[model samples]
Target: MAQFDVEAFVDRQKIGRPQLAVLLVCLLVCFIDGFDIFMVGKIAPAIAEGFGEPVEAMTLLFLCQQIGLAVGAFVVAPLADRFGRRSMLIFACATFGAVTLASVYAQTLFQLSIMRGIAGVFMSAGLPMALAMISEATPRHRRSTFIAIALAGYSTGSAASGAVAAWLIDIYGWQSGFWIGGIVPILCIPLLLFFVPESLKYRTERNPKDPGIARTIQRMDRSVVLAGDEVFVLGEADGTARKAKLLDVFLEGRTWMTSILWAACFLSMANIALLAAWLPSFFQEMAGIPIQRFAIIALIAYGGGVVGTLTIGYLMDRIRATTLIPFYYIGISVALFAMGQVSFEAPIFIGILLFWSFAQTGGQGGLNTLITQVYPPRMRSTALGWSGGAGRIGGVISPIFGGVAIAQNFSLQLTLTCIAVVPLIVAVLVFMLGRNSYARQAVIASVVTQRGTA
Candidate 1:
């Protein structure tokens, strides 16, 4: 009887149409995800104006949405491990879209916040699932790059939200942003259903008898022939034979490492979410930059994020991520300090904003990629989801921080400086993680070498 190692075959194959199709589908999902999630923040001032409230009043909206996101990441995303990544992803897209569209009809900020909170539950599935799908589909050598390329779509979608707001908010009101965000994802459902395949590794582990595995392998490589009676394997030796449990993330000497990751994610995401939620309002209120002008600046800055995402992904493939990601966070601190100093200077501030986004958004991308590498396929989604869910605690806190700063009339310099501190802390945590990861890799390499010599 013929035996096949599914993961080995995937790693050996070159990037082809099948791989590209996976990337494309993931890219679109990420793009729409970024667009919807960031749209409210991008148009916050407009939404506040429409509701006849101070912009700071939107804090509850941000909080509710984030809490829902935390819940979804913790609860909903892990189900992908059992149910299927593709199916869960499609359901998330459809439900999130419908809820987001309904948000446009909300008559008050409170109502909108409730709707956004509901939408957030479904929206939270996008990134982790996209990362898991892309990671499983691509070759091991190029995994980070493929994940990065898909993430660029997320950056693009985020930037696009600012652009769309700049164009549509004044003409069609804030609802227009929600309208586009909602409609696009619902429309993409057909494409996801038809083009994206479930992770072959997932199918193999969950039900080795699944006939779809044979069909998928054939699609991945048209030239390969498979017998109907072949025995399939994942080539994983570490307890992947059984169903994955959440406890698996902490097993295998991962207890300390998981704690470190959760801490780093908490700090890093707090900073990112705070900035995403309030940067537009910050520049408008503190820097006295007009909303329209800042919108254009945001587009330019988030473009830097796209570049950062791709660059980090490429470098991670070549360099140790432990060594590379910390520098990005350090750069964030420097950029934030420089941004505080140059608040009034458009040319200098824009440059600083670019670097900030490059590091901030890109660094977040790096963290996401690292999570994918840390766990085995059986529990990868659970690890990603739980770590992200932990981070959402910080995300939930960020809006309140921003709101407090705005209410207390904090100086722009103080606010930016305070924000700078979090990234520096994150840098330290990432460095520690790097050391731990390096030590583990070294031990593994030594064992492999000794076994070979013996």
Candidate 2:
């Protein structure tokens, strides 16, 4: 009887068309996730005026979005552990698709807020599930880069949202942006069903010895599919599902690592949520750029994120994440500080803000990769879910925090200075993490194992 070790096969083999196929489905949904998540913010200024509400009304929408995200992460994401990532992802995608469409006709701001809150719940689950599946599929050497590439879809989605807003919001009204965001995901549902396979590791883990799966793997990679009834699995225990213990994430030697990761996720995500939610308004109000032009500038900023992730993903493969992550955060501080002191000359101002976006969003994406590295397969989903929940908490607070600052009429320097402190804190925490022997050891174990399932 011939046997194939799935874990060894994936870790040893370079990525191929089979793997790329999975990533494509993940990326497409994440693109939809980004649009659904960020679209409300994109239309905020217009919606505020349309409803005869103060601009700060956007704050409620942002809060509801995060609140939903927190519930999704803390409450919903871990369900993937028992239910499987593919199922959770498809369900979330469908749920958000329907909710986003329903949200367009929400005549009252309160109704829109409620709808967005629910969308956030589903939106929150999309990325972590995609990351887990991608991580499981990728080879160890290419894990960071591949994960970053897939995640780049998200930033691209945000950039696309800016483009849509610029084009549609100006003419058909903000509702059109909502309409576009909603329709695309529903359209993708068919594609997801037909094209995207369940996580390979997951299927093998569930029923490693199944003859059908062996044939599927045979089709996926003929060389790895050994003949006969002998089929084998790697990086996972036998077929019985591993139920997550919530406390297990913090227990074991992972206590400090969990805390630090949560802290880092919180601060970095707060920075991202704050900036992404408010930047267009910032440029429109402060720099007096027209809404359409400012939206394009915002697009440039997020587009820089695509570049940042691709670049950083390459560097992370060579450089230590400990050293590299801290530097990225430091760069974030420097860029924010620079933005404050610089004159609003379009060229210089736009350049600084773009770099700022590049640094901030890239650094945040790194945090996502870092989570995959920090946790092993068994607890990975749980760790990501909770830390993501923490990030959502930060997301929940950021807009309100920024709103209060703006309400008090804080200078851009003062407002930004306050926001800049988060990454600076994250930098210190990252460096301290770098110094920790336990963290270094766990990270090494996860990378070397590369089973990437839980």
For lDDT, the strongest prediction is 1
Write down the TM-score of every candidate: 0.88, 0.87
Q: What digit string (tens of lDDT, one per residue) describes model 1 on residues 317-364?
A: 766677788999999999998888885555687788889989988899
lDDT of each: 0.82, 0.76
Return the lDDT, model 2, position 61: 85
In model 1, where is the ten-residue run with the lowest total lDDT?
445-454
Off by over 4 Å in 2: 1-4, 45-60, 203-213, 225-241, 277-297, 346-348, 400-411, 445-454
Candidate 2 residue-wise lDDT, 164-214, digit = tens:
666888888878877877787677677667766666666666566767667
In candidate 1, list every pair of residues with a backbone clash.
Answer: none
